[model samples]
Target: MSTEESPVEREDRWVLNLRGMSVTKITVDFRLMLFLDSDWEVAFDASVDLSYGTAHANPSVLLSPESQGVAGALALFGANVVSAVAFKSGTLRLVFDNGHHLTCSPDPSFEAWQVTGPRRWHFASLPGGDLAVWTGSGASES
Candidate 1:
């Protein structure tokens, strides 16, 4: 008996855009491992403008205390607040209200992520030279 082999393929990519006075967009390319449950790898591009405000500002405030705390911690960490909060490394770290912290890191080859707390948004340079907004949640708008 002869057996057939399957070929590996690239995964699908998804883009999300939130538009209003401020515009936010994100594109994600991910591969799901068919053999493993809940196993996946992803590349993401995100961009956001907090000049306006988010769709869920009030709700976001109610749901995230970590947002407020992280803002303060970021200031202490010497993160520049004016135009956009920016850090040196590929990893962007923030602490939530509950004291739980989350870090987002892009691949080393990609440009560093730019975060703006005063504007309450972030963006990264995509491989294709496009910008993607960060939308992890608990982001505030000034």
Candidate 2:
């Protein structure tokens, strides 16, 4: 599929905007996810609020030595992520340039991150009001 997408595809849940034009910065906090913002009003993917602290800090976001330097791994997201990976432990990783990386795993009790459209994200509610975040790859019969 062409990376070209209509503006209408932007969803309402993703309140944050990531222009896709050279990521300016990334913020990781007690929140359950990593977020990036760019230079425009365009929306990209994933905007998770880290308020209540209801989520566990499972999985992990690690930085290589080069990615951990004074400059930080910020520029790692400057270019498109080279590859997106899902591990057996339910941890997901986004690989960037210079070997920098970011990984996260939701506690089994927490909703998994689901990507519906091409890199588009959505939340799927399970029974009893629980959620299974969609990790778009791995462990499938594709």
Per lDDT, the best of the predicted structures is: 2
Tell me how far the alpha carbon of residue 132 in candidate 2 is from the true structure, in angstroms, after superposition. Answer: 4.0
Clashing pairs in 2: 112-132, 112-133, 113-133, 113-134, 114-134
Give per-residue CA lDDT, model 1, range 3-75, as digits (tens): 2121111122112111111212222222110111111111222221111133354222211122222232221
Tens digit per residue, CA lDDT, model 2, 29-109: 322223333222111122221111122533333332222322344445454444443333434444544444544444445
Q: Residue 118: error of model 1 in Å?
A: 8.5
Give the lDDT of residue 123 in candidate 2.
33
CA RMSD of all predictions: 18.1, 12.2
Q: What is the TM-score of each candidate against the true structure?
A: 0.24, 0.36
Model 2, residue 94: C-alpha shift (Å):
1.1
**Residue-level lDDT for 99 in candidate 1:** 26
Against the hidden true structure, what lDDT does model 2 obtain? Answer: 0.33
